[model samples]
Target chain A: MDEDAKAVATALARESAADGLRRLTDLLLRVADDDPGLAAIAQELDRITEELDQITEELDQITEELDRITEELGASDDGRRPVGVDPVAGRANACAPPLEVWCLPDGTAGASGSLGITYQGPRGLVHGGVSALILDHVLNVALSEQGPAAAGGELSVRYHRPLPLYRNFLATGRLSRGADGELRAVGEITVAGVVAVSAARIVGGRGVRM
Target chain B: MDEDAKAVATALARESAADGLRRLTDLLLRVADDDPGLAAIAQELDRITEELDQITEELDQITEELDRITEELGASDDGRRPVGVDPVAGRANACAPPLEVWCLPDGTAGASGSLGITYQGPRGLVHGGVSALILDHVLNVALSEQGPAAAGGELSVRYHRPLPLYRNFLATGRLSRGADGELRAVGEITVAGVVAVSAARIVGGRGVRM
Candidate 1:
């Protein structure tokens, strides 16, 4: 248990799988950032990799069984993972920081979180691609309710400034139909109430739904 | 040593730091992709995180010592890590697959490699943000030689097809000067000799130089 978990005892002791994945990612990123020694770190990582392999094998067996049951029951969602398991924005994925976006009453999707060292580029700044990743996911989430599924067509991003890392960020998106009747997701990520990155995405196959 | 390393004796006995990082990432991704049982996996990861923390602490001490020595000797490149350490394309970064770009005599930059499961977005496709991440780095590598440093201004990426995972990818970039004398980087990523994603960037501060 971590300090917070120790202090709280109950609520934080048994960390949720999503929060655990995020915590694991931060630990890995700590390794990626200062990114110390070469072969030596490799040796340690090699050892851990072995352990992860075992865990993966065990998980694979269970997942296969679960998937088989789901298929047999015909309870699949077109083979698409729910937003809770989304690779980028999903709370469960260890790939990047978890992104939580919600469609507001004003018809816009809004998301906010502080990124850590795992998503860095340009020395203490958020990688531009990361910005794109968040915006794209935010947009998809914004319009998911309006359509059955959303596939990205074209994405354009303009970097207004360098978005710093480990800082609070606010992202918002809204759905719009273009002149050709194509749905579009316009999104942006901001720090300190200032928009630093903006994006417009062309969506297809209906928007992504949770 | 693995079977291959034992067979090769000397050559494969030791893995490079970058290769080791990539290997570690793949193992982690296997867990991320299969994404099997959540809570159990987290427990294992939690244990490994403790080990990694110890390694990080040791490495940090050595890294600080080396940095101090480098500074005392005035052996710094303005704190810029070589392309080898780039967070996205650098072999050392476990964030994404390593991208190696080279300048061709034909006045263009060419790069190629197969991305792994860690970069997946759609079910079996590369994340669009990852495509942007790679293309963005590829272009910067292409134009880096033209100037001292490169900073991205505006980046636009168009996805022609859904790029698959664990497949060979070829990326190319070139240096172009806009009409207003602004330097730009244009690049594309292809799989099976077919262009799947293309990008153009407005670069500043001259261009990123190796």
Candidate 2:
């Protein structure tokens, strides 16, 4: 097919998918009505939900696999040093790792990273809570590096802007002493170098082995 | 088997599992080192990770099945009942309806009642981010109740305590007036009459419906 034809086909597919999604949302909003008709609608939407979930899983697998390949290529280009990521220790910490843990020098006290995911709402982007999770991880790392009393006691995340889900994200965290003998930590997730989520935490209490 | 024998067997199984888990954690922590024997260990951990993923999927399925059964029971208890629930419609809207939308009467809100999940943590149980989510949903319902505003603005969620994940929960949300041209909304999630999560937000901007 010609390039124009291909573009038309892609546009049509996108339009159809958007319409289907809109219909599904409408059905869910109507679910509270308890109409007998919903039994059929529910079954139909359940199938759609399962399919969408499957697609999401496939996409995640693809993304992660691609990331692995990219990391391998990047490593090879950089003289084949193994990526220095530390496997996540436990759930007491955030669900993922910091970007600097494997890439930076041991004394590298401060570095920033970001998370880009589909489920975020602002900027039609990653949710603020998700951003907070990233901040927690980043700040936790900062605390861990700064010595004892840096784990995490209280975290305050302020949403400065809606983080768009598009790629090229960044998060940076830093640790400093607060007035009450606690470590004050601040972090931010940025998109295209713009601050989206800003967070502060007074990190104190028992330190866990990260 | 005798009661004592059964108890002994259970204890033995628990001890073995704990030992195995500790061994696995130890192996995972040491995976990155360049040991000749690390390949076998990596294979074993890969198998374990796959098994854990399967277990998580099975548990999620079982939970969904249980929710379905409970929902079916709620429906059969009354023939005239509507289905599902809408927290804003008030009690005047319900008739023990199956899947009925009932406006949760204000002041009775709690964690389990609305979130459909156990409130997990303050950073307050339910995680500050989850609180924001629940509160955002509650506020969304309130927006539906209140006529559209000219411009809505910030959402602030205050964590009073760690929201405990409990069997049953409730939450109440109110949309009220604030100082100058801003709408004030408050939400609280509770468990067995104890407050778990509370949130407040200002709504603004034309949300692009995607």
Candidate 3:
């Protein structure tokens, strides 16, 4: 397979693994008992841990092999932007929910995703910090699409209502060039057509004032 | 084992699983190459996926067994507050970095943690959102320690400098009860005695207006 195809395959495999881990995490958090079955469940957990250790060893070897290959490939080290993968939006990142983004014609961006129990924070509600993460990513994407590359400077979030877990949410962000030449962006996350979280961000770039 | 012991064991096991997943994710994202070794890495990934599938099936059965036990135990269904486990700061949550929090004598909360590559964003820096997450959790913990249970209303973060990944950072938060009875929180994330991110949050509880 070609390099691009291999990259895609690797991302897909990693995403699948992330999905399995997410499920396992959800189960582990919600699973509880005081019955006699507790002993059996604990035993099963022990077995799972043993299996996970074995997998960890195998993964370590794979990582070493891949590192050797990367060295042979002589990849560039810019150290500013990731070469091909975004740790926040990358499919390989199990911590990030699968969000889809689209750039609108009017210098704004739209995003949509269904968050599950794995993102739960306050009981059945989505973790407030996770919402911030999504908004930060979406706003940055919108800013980049409209202007030069920049780094986030200030971000503020308002929680209008509790975002429920296991529901679809829509996020939209718009970018505007501030009078000071800073990139200003606004993002909103809505659940069931109701605004749950709103964010405003200011970003600094090459020609922008701090 | 008793129920409490079982719970602790389960949490530990889940944490181990999360650690393994985090390592696997970091390796996957950092893995790349254009060399002939790509083929071997891909095959190893395939094997990993198969093993993951088997693990998933086993976890599924375990989930069912645990569910039956929970039913027998007659756990309460508040649905708003998790009965036992906290998905955010729970030791079992792989998604949360290992954060240690302690209440200071001055009524403030101090947290310390070393974030890994799993939280990387913007090249070597910790993801902007992850910073928010850690700050939010820490601030809330401070507020709760000083005041009644409340929900976050507004959170504002200022990024003074990039928080580097895989570095130990100190976070501190203090709560002040406003005249309106709202809980106000201020938090700062510092790296090597330099403040990287500062946050202010207002939380609402009984008698507090939105």
Q: Estimated TM-score per prediction?
A: 0.63, 0.42, 0.78
Q: What is the TM-score (0 to 1) of chain A in model 2? A: 0.45
lDDT of 1 by residue, B129-163 (tens): 77877777677667667765455466777777888
lDDT of 3 by residue, B1-210 (tens): 776775665556556666665665555555543334456556655665566556556656655664564564454223223333443466656565667767776768777888756677666788887888878777777777765644747777788899987789998888766667666888799999999988877774332111
Q: Rank the candidates by lDDT, best first.
A: 3, 1, 2
- Report the C-alpha displacement of residue A152, candidate 1, in angstroms: 5.2
Question: Could you say which candidate leads in DockQ?
Answer: 3
Candidate 2 yields a Cα-based lDDT of 0.40
Residue B82 displacement (Å), model 1: 8.6
Which candidate, 1 or 3, would have the higher TM-score against the true structure? 3
Question: Which predicted model would earn the best lDDT?
Answer: 3
Write the residue-wise lDDT of candidate 1 on A78-194 in tens digits. Answer: 343433334465443345565565777656887788776557666777777778777776776676668664655667777778898778899988887776687787878888889
Full-model lDDT, candidate 1: 0.58
**Per-candidate local distance difference test:** 0.58, 0.40, 0.67
The interface root-mean-square deviation of each model, in the order shown, is 9.2, 16.4, 4.9
Q: Score residue A187 of candidate 3 by CA lDDT.
A: 78
